[model samples]
Target: MSFLKKIQQPKFLPNFLKVAIPFFVLVTIFSLAINSWSDIFAGDFAKVAEANFNNGKWKAFFGYKIVFSAIYGLYITNKNMK
Candidate 1:
């Protein structure tokens, strides 16, 4: 079989990647919407985000992502097992 054909099969993807990818994408979209709303009604909080990254404060967000992803993964696992 060709590499492309093999990769097209869902069996190759681990369960966690499948669940985490969609969850991450959804969280990203929601975050962007919140940022846009914050920008329109208040001021540009994008600058604050950038400054946080510059100051290494964004590390906390990465931690949040990992924790949330784990929670989502557990929820999915529990649902699938039932």
Candidate 2:
């Protein structure tokens, strides 16, 4: 498809990776900090893991991170190409 071919161009991958990797890492760390802030302050590390596992928050976090990173990467790549 034209869309696939366009994305497969030599410049696309590097540009996408340049923005996406750091964005993904920063987002992951920021989300963890925010999510664990209360637990950290209260000195309850066990509760953080318990809540994440029991509420299936890990799955939701992974899904959000992937979706957001992909969307942001594509947006930046498109902008740069244009």
Prediction-by-prediction clash tally: 0, 0
lDDT of 2 at 11: 87
- lDDT per residue, candidate 1, 1-82, as tens digits? 5444544556534665678777877875576566465554567776646744446766875567667986786556444532
Highest TM-score model number: 2
Q: Which ten contiguous residues of candidate 1 have the minimum total lDDT? A: 73-82
Error of 1 at 25 (Å): 2.3
TM-score of each: 0.55, 0.73
lDDT of each: 0.61, 0.82
